[model samples]
Target: MHQLTDCQLIQSPDDQAAYTSAINENPANAGTTGRTRRKRSLFNYSKLWANGRTLKIAFLDNPPAAHKQKIIAAASQWLPYINLKFVFVDDEGDIRIATGNNDNSSMLGTDALLIHPDHPTMNLGVPPDHADFDVIVIHEFGHALGAMHEHQHPQANIPWDKPKVYAFYQNREMNPLSKTQVDRNLFATFDTLSAVHTAYDRKSVMHHPVPNSLTLGDWEVPINRRISKKDKRLMRLLYPK
Candidate 1:
């Protein structure tokens, strides 16, 4: 299974065990300064409705009141920084959220519009304590808000140990991913995903915590629970006055 990342969501086929990890970070905070555009641009164009302005979201099967409230709160954290508003609806919406056992995923921005309405483009896992809960909710919402994983930034220079990285996910207890899957989800990077960006922010909510064991040298990021300073800065840049 791919690790827990801010955004690298390609819903796994696993229905029971959330074949998602908690260590994966996808930052296609890619190189936009040159030829690249922004990680979100790597995907197809937004379906317009999902491109700026008010964006509507829905919860499939309707989570419990408490869970729903928490989801709203976590997702709304970005509202103050970006010029985006999230409206929770009962009918067709720009983004739809579903629940899985331990997996959390989301389609980046308007990509959700292409999927069938009956299918969920976003999946939230079982809620944890405040820290994990907030991180998961906000990170997934970050994808909904057009932010990609920060680790995948083309300029992100993370020194990963191939063998150890492969072993880490394949041996996971939940939805374990194969070497190929791990490579695609974790070691993958984008080419032309540039936009208003900050220096590669290891603390960005889009990044996953890399354990020291997974890297060759002394490289690692702890499970980041808060949105980094640059994250807000980039959001403002993406939706400025």
Candidate 2:
């Protein structure tokens, strides 16, 4: 992965524009591709030493208590695999809460953070009331627990059709990327199959949405949802009991 300094150099306005254009032309190329591969350490569970101690987790209060329960349940299911002892705390001292902010969620020192009470997304007026809550909570918690995007795996060899991916992200107005973005994304070392990865899973809960047209080239899947076997193995390795 490009060092933070290198990343800064490419952050120049002209470079940014060029990078944006490149990404707009091919979203799949938003990560490392060739000759940028870096060696990574094997994921070793021994590295994460919870010491048989139950991890204390706390969620700042949010609306629709049911959604909180769902988030907790999802996280719980994945906890054992990581050999972690976890329990949710009820006091604010345990986890701070902000009504409409999630940016600081990771600062609590806890393993995960759920949605804020008044997030715009929750206010969208959907029937289920918590339509995207589960996905968001699970995905973010995956990060708090040290997961990274699967599409960005160092060993990945995505056949990104740059033109198609760039067009899709451009239409969506998501962060525009460049070859540097791609190289930084691909070259960074990972501990293991990130908890974020779904095994070649297009429907994996962690997979980000990419346009169908981008799947035509060397890209293998259209979407991803469930965590992959490789991901599970990596988790076990990272936090093994």
Candidate 3:
């Protein structure tokens, strides 16, 4: 079994501001209908970037050259499927990366704009030497590209052993998560609109590795290292290049 790393999502501090930023960056984020009435609904907006735009990625904390190259390579895997471009830089960027910790996380899409520019929007805390480094990078970038966790898709129907699942994350030594965090990240399901209408894909890199121990019966989803076909299809639908 692949060792699971703590992959938490860093949401913008202010939902309203994040919504405004997302809609302003991409009008499609407001959805097709009810653009006027749904503006007040926190859950109605999508956090996608403007199609065909170039996203500048900046590295903070000055990680090793090799590390930066590996990150760039891993994140680039999504390029062929999407309409957007990525330009890595040393200065300020639309997506800021920081390393040197174990709690890997990223803000969902345009929510990065709501964060302090000096702070990192994404944390590549897993060391480059880790076996799943590339997978983790790809996963974070999936979030940066507006992909939500596949396990949270409303149609997933995972048979989770809630008590054991909660205990495992809460008691884990490295980057322990609270019950609320576990509920939000693991148990909460995404509505169809926010989920982008793709069927739940267990093999998607956007999914967390579900250990059999935390689930009822023999159900388990191993760590997904690469983007799945469904992932590509979903990206194509969202970006339509």
Best by lDDT, which number?
Answer: 3
Instruction: Give the runs in model 1 whose Cα sits over 4 Å from its true position.
Output: 1-8, 11-52, 128-131, 192-196
Candidate 1 lDDT, tens digit per residue, 31-149?
A: 23346544433232211122246777888768788888888888898888887778998768768888654578887554565568887778887464445788888888887666767
All candidates: CA RMSD (Å): 7.7, 12.3, 2.1
What is the lDDT of every predicted structure here? 0.66, 0.42, 0.86
lDDT of 3 by residue, 112-158 (tens): 98878899999888888889989999999999998888898888999
Q: In model 3, which runs have C-alpha deviations exceeding 4 angstroms? A: 1-5, 34-40, 192-196
As a TM-score, model 3 comes out at 0.94
Lowest summed-lDDT stretch of 10 residues in model 3? 32-41
Better of 2 and 3 by lDDT: 3
Model 2: per-residue lDDT, tens digit, 1-241? Answer: 1111111111123434433433443332234344666642123111122334465555444536665566566556667567667676544322232324322123211212222323221111111244454444555445444555555555444666766655543454334456555444433434332423334434444445454466654345543335556656766765667
Show where candidate 2 strays beyond 4 Å: 1-51, 92-132, 171-205, 215-223
> lDDT of candidate 2?
0.42
Judged by TM-score, which candidate is best?
A: 3
